[model samples]
Target: MFNRIARFIPVLQWGRTYDRTAFSNDMIAALIVTIMLIPQSLAYAMLAGLPPEAGIYASIVPIILYAIFGTSRSLAVGPVAVVSLLTVSALAEVAEQGTAGYGVAALTLAFLSGAFLALTGILRLGFLANFLSHPVIAGFITASGILIAASQLKHILGIGAHGHTLPELLSSLASHLSDINGPTLVIGVAATAFLFWVRKGLKPLLKRLGAGATLADVATKAGPVFAVVATTLAVWVLNLDDLGVRIVGEVPQGLPPFTLPSLSMDLIRALWLPAVLISVIGFVESVSVAQTLAARKRQRIDPNQELIGLGAANLGAAFSGGFPVTGGFSRSVVNFDAGAETPAAGAFTALGLMLAAVALTPLVYYLPNATLAATIIVAVLGLVDLTILRKTWAYSRSDFMAVATTIALTLAFGVEIGVASGVVLSVALHLYKTSRPHVAEVGLVPGTQHFRNIHRHAVETVPEIVTLRVDQSLFFVNARFLEDLLQDRIRPGTDVKHVILMFSAVNEVDYSALESLEAINLRLKDMGIGLHLSEVKGPVMDRLKTSHLADALNGRIFLSQYDAWRALSRGGPSTDAA
Candidate 1:
């Protein structure tokens, strides 16, 4: 009971060792992350088509909840770029952007995603995440970054650009090019250029000016905050809003007001698939980040528990009028580098965001949409890894095909179709490969009791007894191949009367495989040829015993191929039931 409780709520394990040193480290890390996250939160929220304060709200309680339930000490949970984009895609389908219904739909998505994640964790079904191959994921993220950057071009051009795909966005922007607000475009372009410079140039310049690496790193991450301040100030001083500047305008102040997602069955049913997709993608991304960070410290993460943590965080986000979030690679790295000692850092960061929600909401009123767009563009652009395409092409052409297909589909269509198609292609690629497993003909190695692949080694072999080693789990797909290979080995009236199947790499034998084996036994029996088994795994032997296969196997089951070779070649009883 105690173990179960601790497993569900991981804070109990880490909280037991809380100390003043840990407190100090966590506090400092939290401070640095809070400073960095403020501008990011507001920007990401805007990107998700929510009120700016929703981003701050997202960072607040969700962090606290994740700290309480999460297993990782360094994983900082909040609104991240991919999850925010997913949120927009999910909500955009149900209601118009910026509508009350859209907001409700976003909250419901968070809740559903959180629930799905929590259920998977409880069932310990985290291994299902493996379905999304790394290459496919990389392709999806790269394409997603492109789409996100393209989508934000409306803010950059100061026009009413609207679309989900890049082409549509371009077309829409072109249609409204004549109506582009000059004032807004100037501010937007300037802020975007300044932020890009800050990200690329600031740290190097700061280090040359005697700034330490740690301080420079923090300041570099805080560059967007500088953009927000500068642009907001310019807008206010120059009365830029009066001249077509799209400011954030009024933001609701105070704590994140508690709310509940719409439970209407129609809404839930409509948003169900998107919620599940968001949950799965979010979980995969979170686990990957958590594992990488844990490796640096020689610590380990429980993927199952991570699901629970992220689930709780998303649930908090839903109820608090935020969107889905996960463990962001950049933020988690910053937390680790800033020397966070425990999950307390997340809680402290939450407190910092809460303070921002209460007091700093007014300061961002003059913040230009262009600056927020700039922040998102700068952040997600790093997610675009074109190197993956080259690497996949060199590594495996099949993987390259999958990666290329996923990227092209994502960009040409929208996010939903892209993700769905990517998953299907990944599964298809796996099945196509596994359906044609590598089968090797084996022979006796020189002066050894072991068998070796005939092609790879100079080994002794007998024409009468052919041995095959299958290097994959036996299932319906490749079951027929086994029989076909056996038939090719056997001649009409040859000396070959015994066939030995060496089951070394085969871990599982499904019903279809068993049926295939029975067919082999029956056919070999009709031909007066014996079908033998060597090195049958214990579990497989037990399973065979449960069926009539052992009784009607047509030949013997040897402990090893060497024993079978010794017994069969001795020319004992050549003719039996087989």
Candidate 2:
């Protein structure tokens, strides 16, 4: 009973092992991530079309909850670029930007998304994330990066521009070109360039100057905070705000407040589609981060447990005056590099963010929105990896198709459309491939008790006995295909009286497939042929024994195909005569 309860809540597993060493490592990692997340959280909140402080609110409680419930040792949970873009996309249609209803709808999205993720975890439905393949995710991220950057261009230019897609954003930017504020442009351009340089060259340059690796890494992570501070101070000193530059003015100072997500039926109905999309996207992102970090430490992550952890994190965000969030790729990598020893690191990060909310909110009053936009641009630009398209295309055409379609749909229609289409496309491709599984005609390899596909090897065969290898499990999608295939191959009044099915690759037999097998067995029975199974896997054999197929057998299940052939063809070929 205790173990079962602990499985639902994972803090029990690591809580006992928490010690001073773990605490110190966590605190250091938390400090680095908190420094990085302060500006990022604020920028992502703006990206979601919410107030800047909402981002801070998101990072605070969500990190603590995920740390307690999540399985990854180093995964940092908060406003990721793609999830934020998706959040804005989902909420934009329901409520106008900057309205109370918009914030409420965003909160509601977090609630619905959290509930959905938690339900999936409870049901152990982590396999659902497999529908979004790595290539598809890469393409989607690259496309989302483009969209996020495009969306932020207005803030960088200090103009009022609004759009949902690439073309729309570009068109709006062009229409508002004359309204661009020069001071905002200068700050945005310079900060963006400097941040990019800091990411690409600053670490190596610091190392060359005799800085230790740890210090260099921390310096690199703090680059954005430096930019925010430097730019904020500049705007305050240079009076850039007087020149019509938009500033993150009057951010509330305090820890996150408790709030209830609106649960109106209409809100639920409206956000349902976006909620589902966010849930799937968030799960995939979280699991990938968990698996990668776990691999670094030679540990294994429970995908199902991770779902519960991320679900709990999102739920925490919803109730804590924030919007939906997920495991951030950059932040997780930073935590891993910074030597985070456990999920406790995330908890410590939450404490740091809480302190920032209380003591640091007033300082950002003069922080230019362009600086935030620059931070966002630099952050999301890392997510854009067009190289994946070329790599997948060169490796596999099928994967390339999935990636291309996801990218195109995401760029053209929006995130919700891209993710939805990617799922549908992936499922359809899987169904298509499974509908006509590999059916290999087999014969014995000379002097061996093994069967090989006839087309792939030179083999020996008895003319009267034919063996076939079914490469896929018996399922509803391809059950009839097998039936038709056997019918087309077997000739009436032929010398073949015995047929063996090599069940090496067959993993499952659903009801529809079972009925089809029965039909095949009865048809072969009428034709005076015996159907036998050889090399049936243990679990499949167990399932067969529970069914009536064994008792109603045309022949018998053999331990090996060679044994069946020898028993059935005993008189025809014998070593004793030799």
Candidate 3:
């Protein structure tokens, strides 16, 4: 009982073994992650159309909650770029940005998302995330990266532009060209270029300057902090806000406050679908990062418990003046690379963020929005991989089509529609391929018991016996196809008296397939032919025995195709016994 309970509350399993060494390691990792998270939290909040402080609040309570419930030792849960975009997309539909209603809608979205994830976890439906194929997911993320970068460009240019799709955003940006602030553009461009260089060149430059490898890495990870401080100082000294350069303005300094998500039916009905989308996308992204980090240390991640962890984190966000958040790829990688020994590092990081929230809010008063936009641009650019198109195209055209369609739709429409279309396309592609399963006509190989595709190998076949190997599971969607293929293979005057289905590859037979089989058996019987089954899987055979099909089968069920061949071939057993 205790072990079963511990699976749901992972902190219980790790807490008892906590030690001084673990504490020391976690504190160091916490300090590094805290420094890195501050600016990102602010930037991602801007991305979500929420106030800067919401980001800090999100990073605090949610990280603590996730550490208590999550299984991964290094996953850093907080506001991420894609989920921020999704939050804006979902809430922008129902409420005007920057309105009280908008914030309420965000809270409601977090609540709905949390409830949805928790319910799914309880139901053990983590496998549903797999319905969105890897190609589709890759396409969605790539397109979303492009969209997020485009969305942040207005801030870089010091102009007002708003849209969810590429065409709209581009048109909006074009119309605002005359209003760009020169100073803001300089800060944005220089900050963006600096951050990009820091990502790729800073560590090597530091190492060449005689810094140790670890120090170089730590400095590189703090690049955003450097950008934030420099821009804030420049803005403060020059009074850039008077020159039409936007700043973060005033952010509240204190711990996250107690709050509640709206429970009104009207808000719930409007936000539920978006909430579900956010939950799935967030869960998939979080679990992917967690599993990857866990694999490096030869650890395991329980997906269902991860759902609960993320769910609790979101619920914590909902009640703590925040919005939907998830495990971030960059921060989690930093936490792992910084030598975090357990999830307790995340909790300590939360404490550090809480201290910042209490005392550091005043320092960002003059922080230019352009600098934050630069931060977002550099962060999301890493997610865009156009090479996926080339790779998928070279491998499978069908997969390429799914990926291409997802990217195109996401760019043309919005995130929700893009993801929905990807899901539909993935399912459709799967059905199309499975509905026309590969049915190979087989014959006995010379001097061997094995059967081979007659068209591909030199094999012996009797004039009166026909055998086919079904290469896919028998399910409702493809049941009729099997019936039609079998009908097409057997001609009226080919002297076919015995038909055998090689079942080595068929792992399942659904109700529709069983009915199809019965219909085939009756049809063949009326034509004075016997239908036999060979090498049926044990579970399938058990299911068949429960139905009347086994008793009504026109021919014997052989343990192997070779047994059927030996019994039915020339100078063998009689037809009825065989």
Candidate 4:
């Protein structure tokens, strides 16, 4: 009972092992991550079309909740770029931005997502994430990165623009070009260029300047903080806000506010699908990061437990005056690299954020929105990898089609459409491929028990016997295909007297497929041809034993293809098999 309870509350297990060394390491890592997350939390909230404080609120309670329930030791939970983009997309459909309705809808979305995720975890349905193929996910993320960057261009240019799709954003930006503010544009461009340089060159330069590796890494992670400070100071000292430089003015202070999401059925019905999608995407991304980090330290990450953790975090967000959030890849990697020892690092990070909320809210009033836009642009651009298209294209045509369609649709339409299409496309492609499984004709190699495809290798075969290798499991979708294939191959032949099906690759035989197999056996028996099966897997054999097909088979089942060959050949003359 305790173990079961501890699974739901992971802190109980890891807490016993916590020592001074772990505490010290976690505190240092938390301090560094907290420094990085402050500006990030504020920027992502803006990206989600929420007040800057919403982002801070998201990072605080979510991090603490995940620390108590999450299984990963290093994963940092907060408002991530992709989830933020998804949040804004989902929220825009329900209410206008910067309104009470918008805030309520955001909370409701987070609540619904949390409930769904927690229920899924309780049901141990983590395998459902497999339905979203990696190729499609890669495509969606790549497209989302492009969309996020484009969406932020308005703030970068100091103009009013709003759109969810690439064309809409470009058109909006084009229409507003005449109203671009010069000082805002200057800060945006400079901050963007500097951030790019810091990401690529600063670590190497700092290392060369006699800084230790840890110092260089810490300094590199502080790049955005430096940008925020410099830009905010510049705006404050030079009074750029008066000259049309937009600022993140008058952010609320203190910790996250207590609130409640709406319970309207209409609102729930409207937001459920989007909430489900967000939960699935967030879960997949978080598990991936957790697994990757855990592998480095030989730790374990329970996916179902991760769902519970994330669900708890989102539930925290829903009641804390924030939007949807998840484990951020960049922040988690920073946490891991900074020598975090347990989820306690995240708790400490939450404490740091709480302190910032109390003491640091006034400092960012002069922080230019252009700088935040620049920060978002630099951060999300890292997620845009167009090479996935080329890579998928070169690997599998079907995968290429799914990925290409996802990217194209995401760019032309919005994120919701793009992800929905990607899921449908992936499933369609899987069914298409599975419905036409490969069945190869085989012949025995001259001097061994091995069998090879007749067309590919020089092999020996008897004129009266034919052997086929089934390459896929038999199921309802492809059962008819397999039946038709066998019937077509065994035409009113002149010399074929025996047929053997090599079941080496057949892992399943559903009822529909079993019926098809029975029909095939009866037909073969009527044609005066013996039918046989060889090398069936254990579980498949067990399933078949429950049916009458084995007893009604026209010919005996053999343990191996070679055993069938030896029994049926009767020392027949061998020739080149075609």
Candidate 5:
């Protein structure tokens, strides 16, 4: 009973083994992650069109919930760039930004996403994520990174621009070029450049200045906090807000507010699809990061349990006045690198964020939106990798088409359409390939029992006997394909009298395929040709025996292809078929 309960609540399993050393390490990691998450939460909330405080609210309950139910020791769950962008996309459809309806819709989306994830976990449907191909995911993320970076330029330039796609964003920015505020532009560009420099050069400079490696690394990870502080102080001192510079103003200073997501049927109908997309994308990203980080330490995570954990976290967010969130790649890496010993680190980080929500919230009142935009711009730009296109192109044309189509559709249309199209295209590509399964004609090689493709190998064949190697499972999609191929290969005037199908590679024979095989048997019987089966797998043979096709077969089933070849060769000339 205890083990079963522990399986569902992972923290219960790990908590008994917790020690003092773990406590020390977790506290240090928590401090580092808390510092990193504060600005990120605020920035992502703003990106989601929520008040900055909502970001901090999002970071708190979600982390604690994930720590309690999640399987990863280092995965820090919170408002991520992609999920936040998705939140904006979802809420935008139902209500105007800054409206109460918008905030309620955000909560509803989170709840819907959480509900879907929890249900999937309960039903053990985590394998559904595999249907989304890696190339498609890479393409979608790369395009989303570009879109996110472009969307932030409006804040950087202090201009009004609104769009979900690349072309629309670019056109909006172009039209608003004349309205760029000089002060905001300066802060945005300077902050962006500074953050970039910090990422590339600051750690090395700190090391050169006699800082230890750990100190330098921590300082490097805290680079965004430095930007926030410097810009916030600069605006506070210079009164840049008076000069048309936008700032994160008046963040609510308190514990996360108790709230409930809207239960309106209309809102649910409008947001449910987006919620499902968010849940799938978020779960895939989170599991990937969790698995990668766990691999580094020789640990493992349960994917289904992770679904439950993330579901619980999002549900916490829905009830706590926040948007949808996930395990962010960057923050989780920071937590891992900072010496986190367990998910206790995440729980500790949540405590720190709660403290920040109460005390540190007021400090960011003058933090410039341009700096947050700069933060988001720098963070998401790292996710953009167009090399996947070149890699896919060099490997497979079909994969290249999927990646290219996903990228183009994402940039041209939006996130929802791009992802939907990628999934559809991936399924279509799979079906197309499987529908025309490879069927190779084989002949016996001389002085050996082996049979190889007649077209590719110099082999001996019988003029009156033919053997075909079916390389794929026999299913409804490709059942007719095999029928047509056999009819074409064995013409009316040909001397072919016996046909053998090598089923060594075939794993299944569905009902439709069984019907096709029966049809092929009847047709061959009409033409005075015997249809045989060789090397049928045990399971497939058993399935075949369940039907009348096996008894109705015109020729005997052989245990092996070589046996069939040997038995049939006694009655024919061993010359290669023309």
Candidate 6:
């Protein structure tokens, strides 16, 4: 019972081994991630069409909850660019942005997403995330990054624009070109260029300036804070606000307030699909990051437990006056690089963010929205990797199709449709491939137990015997294909009396496939040909034992393909063969 309970609450497992060394490592990681997440949280909240303070609120309680329940030592739970874009898209259909209803809907989205994740965890349905193929995911994220950067351009130009799709956003920006504020444009352009430089050049320059590697790395990571401070000072001192430079204004001071997501059926109905999409996408992204980081440390992550952890975190956000949150890729990488030893680092980071909410909210009052927009642009720009198109195209055309379709649909229609289309295409592609599984004819290599494909190798074959290798598991989807293939192979005057199936590659044989096999057996028996099975897997053999097909089989089940070859080549059963 204790072990099972600990599986659900991973903190119990790791806490038992906690030490001062762990605490020290976690504290250092927490400080770095906290510094990075402050501006990120605010920017993401703005992107989601919420108040800047809501982002900080999201970072606080959600991190604490994820620390308690999540399995990844370094995954930082908070508002991420893609999830925020999705949140805005989902809520836009139900409420206008920056209204009370919008804020309430954001909370409700978090609530519904949390509930869905928790339910999936409890039901052990975490494998459902596999429906979104890696290529499709990459495509969706790349398109979303492009969309996020384009959407933030309005803030940089100090103009009004709103849209979920790329074309819509571009069209809106085009119409508002004359409304761009000059001061905001200057701030936005300068900040964006500086951030790009900081990301690519600052670390090397700091090292050249005689700073140690650790100090240089930390300083480079803190570049956004530098931008925020410098830009805020410029706005305050130069009276840029008077020149129509939009500042963050007043962010609420204090810890996140306890709140409830509205429980209206109409609201639930409107947001449920989007909520589910957010939940799946968030879970996929979080698990991918967690698994990658854990692998580097020679650790393992339970996907179902991760679902529970993320579900708990989002529920915390919903009740704490914030929006939907997920494991952010950049922040998690920072935490890992900063030496996070356990999820405890996330908790400490939460504490640091809470203190910022209480004391540092005032400091951002003069921080221009252009600077925040610049931060978003720089961060998300890293996600736009068009090289995936070339890579996937070189690897597999079907994968390229899935990736291309996902990117195009996401850019043309919107996130919801793009992701939905990706899921459909992924499933469809998988079925299309598996339904026509590779079937090869094999014969024995001279003086060895090995078998090779007849067309590809110089091998000896018995004139009366036909050996076939099925390369995939037998299921309803490809059962008829197998039957037709066997019929074609054993055509009119083939001089074959024995048909041997090499089951070495087959992992499963479902009911429909079993029936197909039975039909094949009956047809072969009528043709005076014996149907034999060789090297059947233990579980498949066990399953066959429960079916009538095993009793009605026309020939013996051999322990090895060589054993079948020896016996069948002699045209009778061998007594030496068990």
lDDT, residue 329, candidate 4:
92
**For model 2, how does the per-residue alpha-carbon lDDT over 500-554 read when each residue is reduced to its tens digit?**
8888899998888888888888989999999888888888888887777777778
Number of clashing residue pairs, candidate 2: 0
Candidate closer to the true structure by TM-score (higher is better), 4 or 5: 4
Task: Quote model 5's TM-score.
Answer: 0.95
- Preferred candidate (TM-score higher): 2 or 5: 5
Model 4 C-alpha lDDT versus the unseen true structure:
0.92
Model 6 C-alpha lDDT per residue in residues 1-578, reported as the tens digit of each score: 99998988999999999999999999998999888988898999999999999999999899999988898988999999999999999999999987999999999999999999989998999998987889999999999999999999999999998788999999999999999999999999999999999999999998899999889889888999999999999999999999999999999899999989999999999999999999988999999999999999999998998999999999999999999999999999999999999999999999999899999999999999999999999999999999999999999999999999999999999999987887898889889889999988999999898999999999989889999988899999999998999988898666899998889989999999999999999999989899999889889998999999899999878888888998999755543212
Candidate 3, residues 290-392: lDDT per residue as tens digits? 9999999999999998999999999999999999999999999999999999999999999999999999999999999999999999999999989999999
Q: For model 2, which pairs clash?
A: none
TM-score of 3: 0.96
Candidates' lDDT values, in order?
A: 0.87, 0.88, 0.93, 0.92, 0.92, 0.93
Q: After superposition, how far is residue 535 of candidate 5 from its true place, in Å?
A: 2.0
**Residue-wise lDDT of candidate 4 within 296-389, one digit each (tens)?**
9999999998998999999999999988888999999999999999999999999999999999999999999998999999999999999998
TM-score of each: 0.95, 0.92, 0.96, 0.97, 0.95, 0.96
Q: Which portions of model 2 show Cα errors greater than 4 Å?
A: 1-5, 491-498, 522-530, 538-557, 567-578
Comparison by lDDT, 1 against 2, better one: 2
Look at candidate 1 and give me any clashing residue pairs. none
Off by over 4 Å in 4: 571-578
Which prediction has more favorable lDDT, 2 or 6? 6
Show the colliding residue pairs in model 5. Answer: none
How many angstroms is residue 311 displaced in model 4 relative to the true structure, after the best TM-score fit?
0.5
